[model samples]
Target: MNTPLPLNQIGQFDDEADVVILGYGIAGACAALEARGAGGDVLVVERASGGGGASALSSGIFYIGAGTEVQKAAGYDDTPDNMYRSMIASMGPDQAELIRPYCDGNVEHFRWLEAQGIPFERSYYPEKTVFLMTTHGLMWSGNEKVWPFRDAATPAPRGHQVAMEGDTSGAAAMFALLARCDEAGVRASFDSIAQSLIVDGEGRVCGVTVRQFGQERHYRARRGVIVATGGFGRNEQMLARYFPGLPDTAEPMGIPHTDGSGITMAVAAGGDVRGMDGLIATASIYPPPQLVKGIIVNRLGKRFVAEDAYHGRTASFIMEQPDQRAFLIVDSEIFAYPEIIGANHSLVDGYESIEAMESGLELPPGSLADTLAVYNQQAAQGRDPLFEKHTDWLKPLTDGPWAAFDISFNRSTYYYITLGGLRIGPDARVRRADGGVVAGLYAAGACTAHLSPDGKSYASGMSLGPGSFFGRVAGREAMRGSAAS
Candidate 1:
């Protein structure tokens, strides 16, 4: 057996409890509340002063299958089989199953959210209409449904969006959940960093070592620890180790501190890791302000995707260009829409706005004549003659004073780094390399990989949906284990 590292001493310490939840983000907070519900003592640790992980930076959309009472009452018919098939198709081979549970229990989970006083908005779209009727039958044609995945799924007319105070909507809801935890008397500590896991002679984990407020300390989990510290989107070492070759610029997406501490710690405790090769990448054009301005060039210098592809990765299909540093070409049209430049849709919005605000850069201010002139020039020559736009549709900068932002394709501004974390089975229990359960450990949220057989997100609402669903399940299970002991 390998010798375990000695526990490093730190400042003041507290007695370990039945559960030690790492990371105070959405999943961590949600799980802590659920544990409290089950009468288990819980303490949460977070490195950031403020709570909420990438959850705070989301548009908060979710995917629900059709054919349920909601769809049936609206004359829609969606089936679980169809939804599963579509997810499998979109995610490709082995990557799709990780998300299967969300589809199976989507309706119940949504109802559970309502019970928690959370509200959802319906989003209606045309393709969703077509797919709903053909796949689920007579359902509302409201959602952008992947018909191949489910027999019936029309996006809810108002079920797609959630709003919080100011633009801090996600943060507000998350804080509300944190408030619920406080009412339940769940213990929480901020500015704490989990450095390693405590394992016994037989290799089962007992607790963790954390550093907080410039001090290191130990917290034991009489029941078990939940590693909800999130993924390593900003950790270059983990990124290079798993994804290999992802541009260093990908760092602009999520919190810089979420460097997959949970994932690494779990690996140290004998938990098996899976799906390190898979990544959920988002494409962006605008570099954070102050960095060199990037130029979006197709085979030729020009524009391709709609400046508003902020809607989805559909831009990946539209730009049909090779991955050669092809960024986004923008002009006055882009500037007119305030949402395009900030953290409104893609994750890039936050960092982009920070740079623009700090630098006081006017960003070429709006001028239609100058924008079209450049576009028209490129259109006439038909070769990205000046801007290198080769897709054929993006040419003719007959518009004027255009500008370019270089970005990668198949990427988006805001992305959920879902490729890390402990490998768990369908039951959400952490699994050992020998295929055994890791005693009482569990995981949920983006920190854990979704293992979608399809290469894509499969469905929307995945990040929040799974986090909420599995967090509840895992929390309850942990409590039950604690009580049994």
Candidate 2:
């Protein structure tokens, strides 16, 4: 094993940082904050002009499996074991052991978030039961929807929004954290890209080679480098190479910066990757019907799952299909009930205006009848070829003005960040194929394959829970160890 070299011993030590965090999004900012709180000097770098990777672009629903107090009150006998089993059953057991500890600590992390002045609310339906303990929604600018789940098994109204109605959680979370960081005196620069890991002769990461505004610069870490850089969902080359069936043509409705920078950095350093081919593909209306409500159909113009299904089941059903595309089938009732625009009358129309700027792919700008005609033709045959949909949901397009978008690859409107990336152990450290830690580094948040090795969410809202739990743990652990000398 090689020892990690100090930045001074290598090419040059730009600045001595106790913890150098790449990517200024939630995970990156959280890691920096924790490290700084633990007495480590920190530096944050972002490739974008502002922070908001996927976190900024999200629906802002914090995924928590079970609320702490609620689970205790319910007679369901919830435990970390229960949460782990649920997650494994929902996603896959491949990464279960790694994620269990984090799930166990989820509520504590949320409390941490609350302590940081990030306001959250209990389940809107307080009397009901949910999958996790309690449902909490974030109260930030622009979020207007009430929580969606019921107080049953998974509980309703646990999802939180940044008070900003529609899809503003991404920016809200970023700005909130940015303000906190600025108050904490952590240094950060936007539009700075991390080119590669700065490893020394001993093979441990000492820092990074970064480029900003046509200038190359090196930043050194005295303790460690944390790669909170987002995933590769937008990189067609990487997606095609990893995700076998996913189409790359659909534009990402979320952040534009998630080009798998962290995955690349880790893989280049001999880290192993997994769970890329699987996706938590969502069923959404492409350029969603403006004046009409709709159901997701394949090229055949048929409904697959319930048109009003929640996130997990919706994505799971879509992934089960062969073609991976869904259509928005509408009826006269849909047109009349424009109020159907909201999912459960809570979510505002976030995709309402994208059609004008993103024509050919979005709705309103595209033809509903023409799109449906082509799909209806394909459904008539024994096979649905356009998107290769093999599900039994196929039916004739009897509805008038029915529209369809070829949401294959990249055409779908509501694409969530799949939790699949560099596989890590329970300690939140990246592992080589040989099952040993790749020293001088750590990771957190949705970037790693730690959550959904099976390529799906264990349950709805589990993503944020794990992000906070593991992010806090990894941050603390990384600060505890000395850099390999």
Candidate 3:
């Protein structure tokens, strides 16, 4: 965590640009492109040897709509109002104001992504799966079809993936973004780490101090400095300070560069942080959507959540358990759907009967049996009285050869990323504790708390969706500030 210094204390700049961006991930690259597109000279400094941060390691899914062209071609009717309602319901009302612009401009955002060479197929995946195994461009990334939220907003498939085979869409998406930056003549410096921001006498951010080639140098930003350095998933110190409830054994799922440097730098400059406790823990239990037909039990063998809920919500519930543990109970009839399984998951134990399986798991007497009896009774009638799981996934688990899959956070079966960072306005300008903007300072991506306000309701693609979209907003606004100046 580098400490920011006052402008008067820093020496003359070694380089200068209209907009200086830190971390050349998808967010930073998008910011650079938009800043350049806004007629501002752009400079991108990446800590890695090349572009692509965790964005390259992601599944490359973007949650966007308002009846995107691809969604329309796929015979899905969507509207901004419906998308807005869904986002409010899915991400929580706390995020409604920040997400309103995103929902309203989603169609244009989709078009912008396509214009940047990001491709999407005119197809839809109609399945209750974790990720799109096919080249389908559209699917439900969140629990849109589930109860409560389903009735609150018209459900639509908003998970738009890049049209490419295999899981390389993340890398492919980063490559396309970098290409756009190149075409825009954005100067990129790899292996350059931004340490801290430089602020002018008026308290406006004016430049950045970076370490490159074993030397610390200062670069002036005529307009502003954008911090897109991702989250603090790998920063143990930040996690302990902000997210004390996170289990010690919980492993971060992103690249090592997500060490919360951007958030730290912003904070050092008096930026207020939000949603610091929000963490995106996930148990991606699909390669076989049929596995969702199973039941999830806590240590007491009690059902905690709807088995078919979004994986993030399930993981969050599991983490809140006594020992941060949970198990997915299945039966011999559980057959893997080849097309739906995104990754292979091994079963922990298998037994010839429910009693035998319960004994093998060492659960209390009748705890497993009674829970199963009620669940099986409701499931047999295509109903879930407890969790209200959809009928499509309501099936009895009475068959022999029962199995359990460990979905515990301590068991290395779950991956996580911190979803909290500096608070920012809709224009992506970093805000201070006094409810005022930090002049000339902006942030986006995982480093800013714009989307995913709560981990319990986290949706897939929410990170990259706001990361990229707000990155564009930050860049454009930075350029506008420069023009106004």
Instruction: Give the winner by TM-score.
Output: 3
Models ranked on TM-score: 3, 2, 1
Q: Score candidate 3 by lDDT.
A: 0.83
State the TM-score for model 2.
Answer: 0.71
Candidate 3 lDDT tens digits, 1-485: 46777888886788989999998888898899999998999999898998999998888898888889988987878898998887777677776767889888889988998899988888888877666646788888887877767887878888898877766577778989898888889998789989999988888888899999999889889999999999898888888887777755566887998898998898988899998888877657764688888888988889988888888887788878878767788877884432322222346677877778778777777788899999999899988878899898998998877888777767744568888888999999999999899998999999988577766677788877888999999999999885313
TM-score of each: 0.68, 0.71, 0.95
Which residue pairs collide, candidate 3? Answer: 287-341
The number of the candidate with the highest lDDT is 3
| Per-residue C-alpha lDDT of model 1 across residues 1-485, encoded as one tens digit per residue | 11223333324235577778888777787788888887888988788886787777654543455344445455445566555555554555553445566567766766666556554433233222111211121222111232222233332321233433332345555766777888899887788877877765555566777777877677777777787877777676777676654543443356777777787777766678777655554433322211111223343333443332222232333234655334344443332222234323222221222224112322333332344456555556653344232232343432333443434443434343645567877666788889898776788776777645212432445566567777776777677774212
lDDT scores in order = 0.54, 0.56, 0.83
Residue 102, candidate 3: C-alpha displacement in angstroms: 0.5
Question: Candidate 2, residues 1-485: lDDT per residue as tens digits?
Answer: 12223445556656667788888767787887788789887888789887667677665556553345433433233455545544555455677676666667766766677666665544242221112222234211100111122111232233443344454454556667777878887888678888788776666777877778998778877777777876677877877776665554333435777788777887787677777765554433312223212445444434555433334455566655656644444433333322223222222222222232124333344344455456556656634454334323344454443233333333444354555777767766777878887777777776776465432343434455566556666667778869555
Error of 2 at 297 (Å): 6.5
